[model samples]
Target: MMNLQKKKLYTLLALVALFVILFICNMLLSPYHMRIINLVGINIALVVSLNLTNGFCGVFSLGHAGFMAVGAYVAAILSLPLVKKAIILPELPKWLGSVELSFLPSLIIGGLVAAICALIIGYPVLRLRGHYLAVATLGFLVVIQVVITQLQDFTRGARGINGLTQYTNTWWVWIFTCITIYVVWRIINSAYGRGMMAIREDDLAAEAMGVNLTKYRLLAFCVGAFFAGIGGALWAHLITVVTPLSFSYDRTFSLVVMSVIGGMSSITGGVVGASLMTLVPELLRNLEVGITVGGISIPPLYGISQIVLSVVLIIVIIVRPKGIVGSREFSWNLFKKKKWNTMNQMEN
Candidate 1:
């Protein structure tokens, strides 16, 4: 116990150090590098929240983009200045025009709205398993996109909300990133997390053991959605825009890939995976454009990042299907066997 406590303390100190380092980077990095760092932080929040639902609860959801859309639009609308909102969304009710909020409250409202949506959908949606669940969630994403496109007054139709304030900074993003990590860590160390794991291992057995599948699944889904909402809000403010296309199928695919590449079963996996996926492709993005280095006039590589990432994904799938840190924590512990009492408790 003492050793475990020491480990915990050391981990906290290490995270603090990292936070400080990032804070320093925020101060010193060029705008482009700063943008990349901010994006990495946002991806970390998104991928980690995704890990909570798809990783821990054994739910293969693909509609996280829907939650993100809800969050981004909601936060954007709320945080936009009243005059701007009136211009962009001229069809909105007059009362809504009077209700502009600060950035933090907008983000909280966005997260809450997304969580409520998750709870409403998850109750019935979680009943499905495997690919069916994936399909249903994908359907949800499609629905959200359509709705956003149709709700011209609310979402500004296809053009999307634009020219907003840049409320998201390195500090706001990393703060939420830390919150996401802390919340996920607390959940992972809890009984619900154990039950969710049991469900992942074998839902039939978990059900037999009274693991209250619905409750735990919804818990994970809602929590995950909430943070995803927060991430979407951060993205919107950072980009200073929100649109139907902002949270698309492509976004969902990348996030899932991030979770799988990092380690579906580990919290640190989300961080590593998010960092790797975000940074590597961005670092390679310049290669896609033609550059006149030393007057050589090199042609554009065209999809260099995609090709490299595909190769990496192929390697990961072939060599480590569970991911680089599969079934392990930051300590790099070797794979360990599990006992079955994890999900034996369930309230009927």
Candidate 2:
């Protein structure tokens, strides 16, 4: 227990230090750099939440983008100024139109709404397994995008809500990212998590052993949807717009890539993958315009970043089919094991 407490202390201290550094960087960094940092936090929240269902529960879901859209539109609509609501969404009910809210409540409400939707959807959908479940969830996302497009009074009929208040910042984004990580970690280490993994490994055996497949699956799905909603709220406020185009099938595909590239079964893998996917593309932006090498004028290589990044992803998957981290997590215990191994080697 003492060792556990010490590890907790270390983790807390590390988080404090990282937060302080990020807070300082938030103030000092250039706008572009700040945006990148903020995006990293948003993606962290997203990819980690995704890992809860897709990774821990071993469920195939491709509707994360739809969940995000639900949250983004809900939060964005709520947080918009009363006047903006009146102008942008003239069709809003009088009660909703008249009401205006602060950021925190809006974000939470958005998440809850999304979770409720997920609960309703997952109840029946979770019964399906394999690619059937995948297709079902993906269809759900497609339906959501279509509904958003049709809700002209609420969503401006595909133009989307615009000029949203900027309540998202480095602090809110990263603090939520930390909360997401903690929540998923706790879930993973619980008995319930073990049951989920059992179901993943062998559903027939797990069901025979009295593991509740639908219950655990739904729990993971709802939890993941909740956090995905929060991430959507963060992204909406940061971008100051909520458009149907923003939360399309492509977004889901990219998130899946992040989960797979980092190791879908590992939380740290999600973080690493999110960081890599977010940063590498942005960092390589210069390659799009042109690169002057030793006074040699190189023509612009438009879309080069995508090509190179795709190649890198392919290589990573070819080398590590289980993902970069496989099923392993990054923990301090690993260092102890390494030290003990070295000591034994020396004695031998």
Candidate 3:
């Protein structure tokens, strides 16, 4: 027990030190690069949330972008200054235009609204299984985009909401990313998580074993939506814009790709997947600008990022469909196990 406690303490200290180093780097890095760090954190939150539903519960939900849209709009509206709101949303209601909120409160409100939406949507949609659920959830995404386009007074129609404050710095994003990871990790290790896995294995058998399928499934969906909403709010604040197009099917597909590449069953995979996917596009940006080597100029390649990512994804699917991490977790307990074995051998 003492050794375990010591190990935990050391692990916590190491994590704090790592964060401190990263924070220093963030402060010193160029703004363009700093943005990438912020993006990495946001993507981690989004991927982990989606993993909770599709990965753990086997729900195949594809409407995460819709939930994110809800949070982004709500949080952006709440945080916008009264003057900016008046300027941007001239047709908005007087009450909405006049109100303003700080970042944390507005973000919470956005997440809560998304969770409520999931609760309502999940009741009916969760009844379906397999591809049917995927189609129903996808329909939700389409509905959200249409509503945003039509709600001119609230959303400024297709123009989108802009000039949002940059409240999503590395510190804020990193804090929330840690919180998201911790919460999801706790949920995955709990008895409820086991029940979710059981359902994924065989819903009928799980039901026979007295696992309330609806209750557990709804819980996973709502929790996933809640985090996805927060991620959306962070993204809006980070980029200072929220358009209906930003939350389209393509955005959801990107997230699904990240989760798939990371291995949905592993939380570490979410982090790993989000990091690699986010960086790959930026790293490939140079390919778009052409390169010169040994007095030879290579012409710029258009849309090379997409092609490269697609090829990489196809290869992964063909070679290792389970993803980079699959369902396994990385552990530091190897040292502990070795020590215990040595003690037992000595005693014997």
Q: Which candidate achieves the best TM-score against the true structure? A: 2
Give candidate 3 regions above 4 Å deviation.
1-3, 293-297, 334-348
The TM-score ranking, best first, is: 2, 3, 1
Residue ranges of candidate 2 with Cα displaced over 4 Å: 293-297, 339-348
Clashes of each: 0, 0, 0
lDDT of 2 by residue, 1-348 (tens): 127777777789989999999989977899789889999999988998898899878888998989999999999988899988888899998888988999999999989988999999999999999899999999999999999999888899879889998899999999999999989888777777778778888988999999988899999999999999989999999989889999999999999999999988778889998998999999788889988899998789999999999899999999998788777777755566652221111110
Best model number under lDDT = 3
Better candidate by TM-score, 1 or 3? 3
Between which residue pairs do clashes occur in model 1?
none
Instruction: List pairs with backbone clashes in candidate 3.
Output: none
Query: What tens-digit string does per-residue lDDT give for candidate 3 at 1-348?
Result: 236566677769967996998778877899999899889999999998899899989999999999999999999999999889888998888787888999999999999999999999999999999999999999999998999999999999799999999998888898899899879877877878888989999999999999999999999999999998999999999999999998999889999999999888778778888999999999998889999999999899989988998999999878879778787654444455543221111110
lDDT of model 3 at position 28? 88
Sorted by lDDT, highest first, which candidate order results? 3, 2, 1
Better of 2 and 3 by TM-score: 2
Poorest 10 consecutive residues by lDDT, candidate 2: 339-348
Where's the lowest-lDDT run of ten residues in candidate 1?
339-348
